[model samples]
Target: METALTLQRTRSLRWRWLWLTPPVLFAALIAGTAIGETSISMDTVLKVLANQLLGADYAVDRIDAGIIWNYRLSRAIVAASCGAGLALAGVVLQALLRNPLADPYLMGISAGASTGAVGVTVAGIGAGAFSLSAGAFAGAGLAFGLVVLLAQAAGGGSCNGRSAQASGAIILAGIAGSQLFNALTAFIIARSASAEQARSIMFWLLGNLSGVRWDDVVLAVPVSLAGLLVCLWHRRALDVFTFGADSAASMGIAVRPVRGILIACVALVTAVMVSMVGAIGFVGLVIPHAMRFIVGSRHTRLVPASALAGAVFLIGSDILSRILVPGQVLPIGVITSLIGAPTFALIMIRGMRAR
Candidate 1:
């Protein structure tokens, strides 16, 4: 009865907290843009947004309008999407592998994605009017397939029956593949015959939101939405897996096939995101970990909470990117790595101590 009461209380709390998420996330995103050197008041920011959104289409000022619309707003959305995608991927990978440390990039997805993006940028894969996102998508697809194949090889073909040892082996293979892809990417960067080509490759690899448009948002939204739905639908299965494969199987879960499909879906979603935004890192790594404390590991709660947390984190980070230096903006990826790496290290150290 006490346990039941506790669960009820917890659910109540989550229900209340969930209501605050959207406003807080949206506020943070808008506020992040208001902090730069040409700092606009929140009132002005809101007004500009209201006017533009309400189809007034009149600039409070040309400068404020440009800063608010052309630059900061788009960047915020990109950051939020990247964050949400990464965190969702992280949760999916962790659950699929049944390991706290598993991430989408753990299986060399990023490296493969990077290779494809870099190859296109350097090799000039598209003709005039072609898009870099196409190459990025192709790269992400190839890399994702390779990781699954390598994991299967490590897992003795079925790859469905996951053991700690199998998980470890899969991780190692991913690392190796990532390293190989990174080396090739470096070679492409080095052999670039022109400064422009080299610069483009470097910027893309570094990750940025400089030229983001409605089109980028359009491409990313459907894929991200689909992936989120998949994650949510499989949440119960993920919770079951935490208990063990046998336990999950006993509960009628088809562990292997579900995991494979989830992984593929996450990869496809992530590949599209990376193709669009370059390789933004660590939102996945950080957000899910943080949300787990609030929501526990129940997929129903975890999936939505993690998505919100991720969106919050990345939007905040992107806002920081623009305002961090006057007249200079850093890549969203760099901000995430800078903030995420230290947080990750702390999580690692804490885990080691607990062990």
Candidate 2:
């Protein structure tokens, strides 16, 4: 009875905190918009948002309005969308693969996307026709396909039965695929890129958000929403996946089809985000783990918690990237790596202690 009561209390507390998530996410987005190199007041930010979003005319400085609407707001929205999408992808992969360290980029999607973008930019792969994003999407698909084939060849053909071995095989395949694509990207840079082109590719590979605009927001927002909906729809299946695939199959889950759909969803969402912002790491890997601690292990709570926390965390990270080194913008990936590396270490230490 005491254990049951304790569990009930925990659930109630998690739900209570969940209600606060959306407001906190909104505030974080607003703060991201307001605290750039040229600080715009929150009031001005609100007025600009109102003017642009709600068709309300408030007397805001034209330059501030333009910066808030065109630059910062769009960047924040895209950052949030990317964060949510990556986090959801992480949650899905970790759950389905039964691996604590699984992430959106585990399938070599980022490396593949990078290679494609570089091929287009440096090697002229598309003869000046395909956009970088198209190249990236294509490359990501190719890489994922290769990783899947490699995993299957290595006896991971099914994500059921001997799940641990299957998971390990897939992880190894992903690493190999990532390394191959990364090498291809480097080779293209070495052989074909001028200093200027190499510099641009390097910046983008570190995750650049300076180029994000309203057009990106259009693509990112819907993708994130769709990813979240799909994950949530499979929340129960994810919960059962904690016990491995055979257990999930015993529970009436169509483990193979479900796994395929979720993995494909993650691949598509992750590729789009990488194509748009380069490769931002750790958001996917860290955010889901962090949310599990806060909201408990239940996917019903964990899914949305991970999404909201990831969105807020990225917005905050983006804000820091802009202001951390005054007069110069750092790649958002650098900021995340700085934060994620230490946080991940601490999480590992705690996990060891708990065990």
Candidate 3:
């Protein structure tokens, strides 16, 4: 009876988090934009957002307006979008693969993107329309195609009395693809690259927000929304996956196609995101797992909660990266790793104890 009561209490708290998540996340977003060197107050952020959101044309100082609208706000939007996108992707993969440690990088997009970016930098490729982002996207697509071909060619697409996660074919294929692309990237970096180029590649891999702008903000917002919607739309299929393939098949769910669609969604979103901001890690890996404790394992609740929590987590991490030093913007990836690694350890311990 006591254990049951505790579970009920936990469930109630999780539902409360579901309601409170958006407000908290938006607050963090606003805080991230407002807390920079030339601090824009919360009131100013509200006014700016209100004017734009409501088309009210509220009066504000030109300097403050420029700072809020042009730079800080744009950066915050991009950060939040990337966070939410990556988190949603992570949720889908973990559910699809039934692996708690699964992340956006598991699909080989991160490695492919890094390779593309590195090649573009080192080889001076893409003199015309072949830009860095384009290269990254192309490379990610190539990696995705290869993984799909390999995984689906045999047992990855369909399950024959074995769980998808246990089959390990998709995971193995992804690892192979990642290794191949990473080796290509390393070779490019090792051969004839200057110190400046090497440093640029390193920063890109670690993820810097210095290049973020309204473009990323505009592109990422819709992509994030679309990806989240897709995931939520397919939540039932993901939940069915928890019961293993035979059960899911018995329930009339096409496990193979559903898995494909879910993974494709993750890959597409990750490619679009990482190509813009480099591979921002842990937002996806950590947010969903953390949220599961609060919201339980239902993707309906888990997806939305993870998205909001991810936005907050990344925005807060971005703020820390900005303020960690006087003038330097530290890599967002490093901050996430520092925060996520400890969080992962704690969760693992809790999970083991529960078991």
Winner by TM-score: 2
lDDT per residue (tens digit) for residues 76-169 in model 2 = 9999999999899889888877888778566587788888878887899989999877788788878878977898999885445356788888
What digit string (tens of lDDT, one per residue) describes model 3 on residues 1-355? 9999998898889899899987897788789879876767788878888887788787888888878888888888888888898999888877766667667676677888777766675777676557766677677778767875777785566323256445477777778888888788878887858888778777877877777889788788998999999998988877877666677788998877877777667776787778777778778888888998889999889989888888888888889888888888899899999999899889889989999
Q: What is candidate 1's lDDT per residue for 1-355, written digit by digit as tens?
A: 9999998999888777667888988887887667665778887788788887886654488788888877777767766777778889999877766667677666677777777777776766565334566676677667666765877777633334357776676667767777778787888778763787777667766677777777777777677778889998888998887766787899998877887778777777777777777777777777788787677778898888888788889887877787787798787788888998999888778768878
Q: lDDT of each model, Cα atoms only?
A: 0.76, 0.87, 0.80
Ranking by TM-score: 2, 1, 3
> Which candidate leads in lDDT?
2
Flag clash pairs in model 1.
Answer: 87-284
lDDT of 3 at 64: 88
Candidate 3 RMSD to the real structure = 3.3
Off by over 4 Å in 1: 1-4, 57-59, 126-131, 152-161, 244-247, 349-355
Candidate 1 lowest-lDDT run of ten: 154-163
Looking at candidate 2, what is the lDDT of residue 11?
Answer: 86
